[model samples]
Target: MNEALVRATIPQDLVKVLGVEPRTDSQAEAFTRSFLKNGIQPNSRTDLNSMLSHKAVVLGYARPKKDKSKTKSKRAKGLNARQKRAMKIFHIKPEHQRYELFLPLHELWRQYIIDLCNGLKPSCSPQFVQQKLLKADFHGAILTVIRSKCPSHVGTTGILVQEFKHIFKIITKEDRLKVIPKRNSVFAVEVNGFVSHIYGSRFEQRASERSAKKFKTRGTIDL
Candidate 1:
């Protein structure tokens, strides 16, 4: 679309919402002509305002309107040499600092986790690490960590269960002879307790399951 039309037609509310001051008649119209003549174009909402992978947000994308740079044997235009110098002197250059940064995913995740942990009420506790594993299909490992530490799974499960329960009793005051759930069959590896890293990280779900097996072996190995 013609940038002039955009400048003329775009809603005032949109400019205000984007925090960009609405262009006055002279500047907007002049810039629009310069842009069209120079083969540079205006970007719409999506392309113009974007968050880079590194979390930096660019407010505008002012790329060349044409790909004339790749054309060879292209003759120069009728603009005089002194005019060219003046144009260069009066050109508006895009600067790096002009961009605005939106929220980055990683930072969002970190804040979310911290907020959840802090906001754990008695009625509904937030278990990020545990839930994250389970959601990622690491259910096998979650059980392993819980069960391996259970005395209810001794022979059918492992001596580790009883031993872990012992430590649980000593550490958690409520753990004194509580009726712990029996260990699930075919699930023995606790992730947090394991020292070896899991493979196939590309398979996030399966990898999470295997990786989570560590929490079991990495459990308190009694001295």
Candidate 2:
């Protein structure tokens, strides 16, 4: 299909993929534009009949509650490939002049960690972390935050936030990076004074456990 036809048809396809019961024509159009830019796929039809004979869009006749505006649309930025992939399971809604989308269960855990850090005083400095990879106190504090903050630590013991190592290094030493969340959860944040979902994770699970067990048994750092 040509880009225009594909683009034109994309609104219907995205709603099918997004599973939102197809609310409005504008919502579908916005979704299609974002989905195509992000590289999401559409479902299959067996033949021309399925595509043509079944002329009904799942919620075709329903009109949107609000008028669609280019100005409102432009105010909200677009989604990239990675963000789109992350949002595959999320639910999207129109509100407050933007699309707010989320993965409910996943965010519950992520939010807990963020809330904890935001509550804590910034006592653990980066020089303290980098020079002494063995900052017993701060390391202990981090592990405590992880355990209390994340139950999934019982599994991989906490690696999801570890992906942001580049982000963390700045917070630890010379640079302070800040994260401003987008309407979409997966949107990237810029840094300055805020810590991102990214932090340099030399956070090793096995080593921490081994060291703790050894200290308990022999009362010494594991070497």
Q: What's the TM-score of every candidate structure?
A: 0.15, 0.16
Candidate 1: misplaced stretches above 4 Å? 1-103, 118-128, 136-223
Name the lDDT of candidate 1. Answer: 0.35
C-alpha-based local distance difference test score of model 2? 0.32
Per-residue lDDT, model 1, residue 164, is 24
- C-alpha RMSD between model 2 and the true structure: 27.7
Assess candidate 1 and give its TM-score to the true structure: 0.15
Candidate 2 lDDT over 132-154, as tens digits, reads 32322121111111221234222
Summing lDDT over every window of 10 consecutive residues in candidate 2, give the lowest-scoring window: 165-174
Winning candidate number (TM-score): 2
Error (Å) of candidate 2 at residue 4 is 99
